[model samples]
Target: MLLRFTTLSALFFAYTLAWAQQSNSLFFMHRIPQSNLINPAVQIDCPVYVGVPFLSSLHLNLNSTGYSYNDIANGTGTINFPALVGQMHSWDYLSEELHYTPVSFGFMYDNDQYFNFAWTERVESKLFVSKRLMSLFANGNTQYVGNGLVTSNPGLNSFYYREFSFGYSTRLRGDVLVGAHAKILFGLAGLYTKRNSVDIEIDALTHNINARWNPQVNVAYPIGVTTDAAGNVTGVSAGAFSPLPFSLNFSNPGLAFDLGFVKPNDPITWSGSILDLGFIWWLKSTSRFTNDGHFVYRGATPADLTNPDAYIDMLADSINNQVQFQHSNGSFVSFLNPKAYFGGTYAFTPQLLAGAHVRTEWYPGRPVVGLTLSAIAMAKKGSSVSLTYSVMNGSFANIGAAFNIGGESFQFYILADNLLAPFYPERVRNANLRFGFNLFWGCKQKKKKLSIPESSGGGCFWTWGLDQKRKQHGVK
Candidate 1:
């Protein structure tokens, strides 16, 4: 569990990933074929689109609300433990989401129906902390000799998996569009933790600490891991993971569903979707640990502070003596974080549209609710550009943009949410970017154009009056 927590945090810092990588900026870019990734119900006019295999999407996100880099160090690069503590909240936490797409494609079927598929790998994790836990680790418990602290809030959850998806969409009667997607999931790795309750109190007279702790942890590892007499890991498992086909082994399997709808009312379109409603069962190389009852700590003496190493050793010994972890081997099931979206767009003209959306994405104990306003400029040649401003969670200052360069045979698109993070991390807490290339086929015309004699001196306009309307519209 310690390794799982620390390693995930290191990866976020090492990669400098941020929170706003859900590709929200591309949602309104109508001409971009990738818009469907945001909402399966979003039907673009693309007849066929084949993504550039592994280049389809690579996304990373880091979630946090406390301790920006500057909070821990002043401009002179000096460690300020006091400053860092001051910047922390009652609960400080961080999480990450990573995604890699191996293959993706979309095609229109039965004239009005759209079909799409994709294979993706995903990793998601969240690390939580309580102020009491932080103070206990940093300043020690003696500082608050009489304080009763609650340290049960700390939590950690991480999951890794692979997903294969199939989606279909078609227009219903009265021009109402409906879509649904089914996902098959394969679990690769996981660490799930639940803290039932914890309470701690320090007796002012004797400086004796009484603690009540209850927690549960479950994990999955590759084969050949050695355990000690107490079920503690004595050695790390060795080997690289194999990306074998999911069907080769169904040791871990899960299912999910996504449903979406779009209703176009002339100048306005209303859209909504429910996404990632799913779960996965883990059966391979799984284990769980649980702890209950009380742990006591005789507060550190004044002399103990002089030798930091001795003090830590004593604390570790005390914790081990009091907290008995019961280990068990078992299979467990986990659920995916689901999301909901509602949005509407108003078209001022055929080429200009303004839209706003309310999108909610959830984590174990956190739900991110975002509101975004976007404007898209669509071109007749299947090109588009969009700008967006979003407010989400407790932090704002999220600005995003997307530009799609379209051609007859190929399309390239770039999208970013929270543009400020790339340039100024200090002021931006969330950031994201998504780019991809797709080769596509356009809609096929069902009815051929009528042949009209140019020599007639007057084209199909003789009686239809359409030529006059076209001339009025400056169609030439």
Candidate 2:
């Protein structure tokens, strides 16, 4: 029975790893308007810009704290479970997230203030697993006969939602730029664990299994539930399938805010931001599933072990008969994962700069921190490229890169935290990509003064303006 439970947990863990979250490479690329998503104070030089509807901005992220795909699969394309389990830490996590912007636009006001609006759809999921549980799955329970096993509660959290945000930024005293984003969120579906105290213990002498499983899981999804005469949940069924299960839902609403500031001092600059500090209340189609108390089972006999198929069926029957699920409808609150950033940059020249950034992401457990160093080069035509190196999530080989290319009227850009993941996915533990297209207008460029010498004829020789001199000198 424990083995069966472990198997199901492993499957769910794999499913969550398919998608992941967030991109740090976009933080330093100020040439792209999307950079403001991370730091609202980041100002785009253009006076006005509009995203190209669905093609505007799309982001996808996938990562694992324990191991990469290569760690499990061998050259012959077979899984090495023991090797995979050996490389796992005491607690490992798999996370996935996606963000898509269908509508977005921004404009600068009076060369001092900026305003923008966007509507985005987001999906995020995470799973936490313990090393002991994985070991039992890889190696059998017999190895842990003498030394019993105790594991922390393994849980999963997933949700889908939509966000409509309005942002404003203005220059403060001493040219300090400050900004904020007020967001309204509508949650569509979610599966969250409210309480978990599920533990399994094996007796050293008698080989008896004692399991104390009392978990409360809250779900807000569109599905039908089956119940018995006594109101106990018997089964769940999905009547019809939809490609996008939670397309739009307004029943669960919430509010969030982001605050940021940028301070410029001569050739050096400082910036900081706090993002997504808010929560959502799940109220529609919400249900809670929970169990009662403890259950004990004797070790499997020799004959039962020999016929594994029969033993599995017997175990299933035993579990169904002993463990009863109680279902109830109730509303619950879920908080958004918040992130903080603090960084500074040094200008080497008019078109080149170097920067260092520190980011911390807060979760229910421990906060994940990362350090990134980047070098950026900009062109006069509103184009730029950046290269970065980051250290985070216990994996150090993070080489990030970003580029923006286009004239003043249109632009296309791509930013990635780990470019190597696409080629050698099995070798890297982190991967994220953000790409978009936008139309830009009224990009202001600084006008340089021309130094012309006076002729011997006196008074003032005929001299052209800076713009005319640039044309005569073949300057762009």
On lDDT, the leading prediction is 2
Candidate 2: C-alpha RMSD to true structure equals 6.9
For each candidate in turn, the TM-score is 0.81, 0.86
**lDDT for each candidate structure:** 0.68, 0.75
The reply for model 2, stretches above 4 Å from the true place, is 1-5, 11-21, 76-78, 136-152, 239-248, 444-476
* Pairs in clash, predicted candidate 2: 19-96, 20-61, 20-96, 20-97
Across 55-127, the per-residue lDDT of candidate 2 in tens digits comes to 8899988678766666666444566678767877777777878889999999876556789999999898777
Error of 2 at 238 (Å): 2.3
Best TM-score goes to which candidate? 2
lDDT of 2 at 351: 62
User: For model 1, how does the per-residue alpha-carbon lDDT over 1-476 read when each residue is reduced to its tens digit?
Assistant: 32233334433432343354656786666566666666777565545678888888777777565555544554545545555556666665676778888799887664457789989888988777655556654565677776677656466789888899898888676556788889999888888887565677878888676878677888876545565697654454535566574325557889999898877665567778888999999998787777775877676688998998999887777766566677678988888889888898886655677899998877655566778899887664557788999886456678889898873467788888788886777545677777888886643223233333322112111111223323322333
